[model samples]
Target chain A: MYTRQNQKNLTSAQRKRFVAAVLELKRNGTYDEFVRTHDRYFVPDDEDGLRVGHMSPSFFPWHRRYLLDFERALRDLDPTVSVPYWDWTTDRSPASSLWGEDFMGGTGRGPDRKVDTGPFAHDRGNWEITVGVTEARYLTRNLGRPHKPITLPTAEELKWAIDEPAYDVSPWDSRASGSFRNKLEGWARNGAERWSNHNKVHQWIGGHMTGGTAPNDPVFWLHHAFVDLIWDRWQARHPGSGYLPAAPLDRWDRQRGRVLTRDDPMPPWNVTPAQLMSHKGIYRYEV
Target chain B: MRPYPTRCNPRTAAAVLTRRAVLRTVFTAGVVSATAAALAPVFRSRRTVAPAATPGPRPAPLFEETYRGRHISAAPAADGSRGGLDVRIDGRPLHVMRRADGSYLSGVNHFESFDSPLDLARAAVDELGSVRLAAAPAHHG
Candidate 1:
């Protein structure tokens, strides 16, 4: 299986190939379609369009399948390209080399905060946004301008989240108070500090990365890859912990008539959480 | 037929028979009138109306309207409670719910809390922006 490597660890050649393959996807219109699909789900007006991939236990599986699809698309163009994971906790600043012209690109500029340098820059004409815009057409990033000083979770904080006894707690959602998933997802906060993790990173990135179609930014892959890596780590730590709300357990069908169960097929994909619990046949992350 | 009251001739008997026929006709006419009055409303209503029209879909709100021009802020609370900070958007509580685990959840999206109100508000703005143009008529081109 192709291994997903830390973005900071990628060799110069590997980084170049990854960048080129992403450009190729954008050039072919496949990338924008992915962005559009994600946008549709997150902001669906109908009951069927609730954010199933988010605010629920399906978060991990949905994103895992989604990332796999994207990776496969990239590999189709360049067999060597694999999506890289960005350990934001290690970098923690806008000045990271990952934002240089050679890699993903730098922070955005004024007026609209659109990036002026890098492969995905509007000047390059390859990363134009085909979806999720009403007036402006370029990708944007304010990069900590619109929020507090950007910071990533510390090792201790991550350990605290991973050490929980259960994968999820009652409610099993963003509102779940005692859930490791909620804590890691950045919704569960300690005391009154507010939840701060995945959500914080997205806000820290700013611009298009903050939006539902954040995948429009190539960094979106790196960010999510790392998130998946954390989930993998959590699974390893709690070997006995399986997905919550097991089958035969009834959860009212807010979207449809059927009650939700672990075995129930996740919409927009044919897979279930049980199927995605392990990375066995799919791919592995390079530690 | 009784042959009694022979003195009572055929003329009086015929008159009595005519009176009984007139009374029967009046009673039959009254019944018909009463039945028409009772049934008139149902037929009249049916003729004038059709089955209720199915409600058209309700339109989604505009992105700008979600907050109602309210600014979101997250800052340390003055009360000095253990909660650290208060998050408010549009001058209303935003990420105010404290879970049993001590993590904060936003009432806005019921998602994770932000490190600051600014962070939380930014997420809310991004979420609101995700609304498709068809749903957000004001933003439509």
Candidate 2:
């Protein structure tokens, strides 16, 4: 078993080892593969088509497995290294420790919005964006989206989502309302604030973080780790409640071939959301 | 942001639609006719010259416009792939995909799908701010 600590609490040495492992993954081309994989699986839900990653009930499980694969890759380099979580609810500033030059680095600056400080900065020659939507080689970020003035997810906003009882509801997509999965996944269609939680944080970061190739920014793992922790907390709070859509939808149903049931196998590893229901002995979040 | 979640609200959407309809009619006549349109509104009305059919909302021009000082357009991809559209902003290619839900998403702002490719392209421009989108690599697996 391993512990995923809060990123703010990580010591300088622990941060060093984690950064080293990620840079190694980038050097060996494994990092780019993760970027490509996320871009590939970020399928949006539509009529009669399968979607396991985003916009579905499996968004949590699929990403949980994806993070496990990534953490395992990091452990291959150093057994002590575990992915840390960035609780955006608290660490909501550009000046926060999360963006310090010693670790994940600061916001992208200048006309190009390029990250020029910290280890992952482009000029350092250690990190280059190979698998990207655009030809830009540098990793970029616009923390707080200066001109837009967007804020991070608030603690109150998070409480509102975790309070939800059902794992998911009908249609099992982004538009699905009143589901814990949809709420935490952060697709708010009712008000002027369209993106609230997870999606909003992505927007707050801007640049490559806004798109499919977001993993190019090393913080992707930490951001996801925190999101994964929320699932753990949700599970503990609602032990009686479990994953919804327990059985596959009827064959005639439009969502039959599209949404993954509790037992349906998620691709890349063929593990079902049922199997990934709980982390348990595998790992635990350090709360 | 105007055409986003605010557009999702039925009440606000109606307001936007009402304003949009007026702008659509005024902008539809042509740039040269903008001044004379108010004076000769009846001549500018399509119903006066043509039939009453085709009286619904005029479709938005999907291509060739400057968005936030950035020139953006969408065209059928050269490869002829299904739902494949070659979108660009400021002369650089902006990758786009068609969702089964009939919305369009782009390389930037991939999470939030837009109602049309034009909206998707504009979102990318907004996300970029001052930084320009570089030419994407020829292939992405």
Candidate 3:
């Protein structure tokens, strides 16, 4: 099984190869397609099959499959090129090597919030934003702008999130304040702090990471790899929790009728939660 | 039913109008009252209750448009995946999404988040306010 390692752990050569592979993918137009898919999923309206991955308990599984799909695409080009995870907790500053000129790039400058440093920089001419809300085609960042700042989540907070026993509580969606899913997604508060986990990281990064087409940024892969890692950890902690909206299944979806179960078909993929939970033949995380 | 008195008292006749006239007046009064009551709700409905701002159509997906130096745009999460609302303004991105508990979420700020579309729109407007700043040359980065 292909092992996804931490971004900080990758050697210089590994980082170079990884960056090269990513740039190659961008050149081949594969990266833009991923951005297109993520942008489509982030569409705001809830009408007719809109937001199933996020806010719902399925967020974990859906992203598991999404990251896997992305990893598979990278492997298709070069088997040695594995997706890495970004530990924001360690590389807390915007000046981290991940954002250095050779890697993803640093914060946007001036009013445009356009990122000028790094390989994925807009002026680099190699990374063009073809999919997103605006027609402007350029990679952007506002790393900790004066109004908005990035706060890397702490390990204690992540530990608190994982410690929660239930997979999700009532209203098992993104808004469920106390549920692990809601807290991990960064919608609900963590008692002391208003922002937490995945959502916090996204907002903290701001710029392209916060946008609908976040996948346009190569950092999206590393960030999500960490999220997936957290999921695996949560699963290990609560092996019996299983998935939610399964069984006794009386929940009604006003729009679609019954709520989705673990056995229900996941969109954008043929597999179901039952199929994703194990991750046996698919791949493994090298945590 | 009450039996009619044999003698018609003139005083009573003077006090009460002709049966036909009385009936006409009563029916007319009843009709007017009913009509007023029936039309009451219509008038009330027409009266502006607070004049709360009506939410406009969900803003169209802004594709790579820049205002001032900030950018405003939207897009679906990913096709074939469970979808969610993803909005980006300059550096901040807002997610208007549903939760597992059936509640919706709108990313307002680092410290605050909301579930209402109106709130989401208002937050977005405020966030995009930076776009109103004086326009600079096209971002070269």
Best by lDDT: 2
A83-153 per-residue lDDT for model 3 (tens digits): 88998778888878888766677877755566788888777788887765444467656665456454788
Of all native A–B interface contacts, model 1 reproduces a fraction of 0.04
- Off-target runs (Cα >4 Å) in candidate 2 are A190-192, B1-61, B75-86, B98-103, B130-141
CAPRI quality of model 2: incorrect
Question: Arrange candidates by lDDT, highest first: which order?
Answer: 2, 1, 3
Q: What are the TM-scores, per candidate, against the unseen true structure?
A: 0.68, 0.82, 0.70
**Tens digits of per-residue lDDT for model 2, A171-265:** 78877888899888887442566767888888889889998889999999999999899998888888988997899785434466678899988
- Selected candidate, larger lDDT, 1 vs 2: 2
The collision pairs in model 2 are none
Please tell me which predicted candidate would have the highest TM-score against the true structure.
2
Q: Write the per-residue lDDT of candidate 1 for residues B32-137, one digit (tens) a residue.
A: 6555455444433322232232255422211222343445555444332213344444444432333323334333333344443355565555543332221111
Name the candidate, 1 or 2, with the larger DockQ value: 2
Count of residue pairs whose backbone atoms collide, per candidate: 6, 0, 44
Per-residue C-alpha lDDT of model 3 across residues B35-84, encoded as one tens digit per residue: 54554443333221222222554424524455444465554332212113
lDDT tens digits, residue span B8-58, model 2: 235645755676576668658564544533534332232112112223454
* Model 3: residue A20 alpha-carbon error in angstroms: 1.9
Let me know the TM-score candidate 3 reaches against the reference structure: 0.70
Q: Model 1: runs farther than 4 Å from truth?
A: A43-51, A251-260, B1-141
Error of 1 at B105 (Å): 12
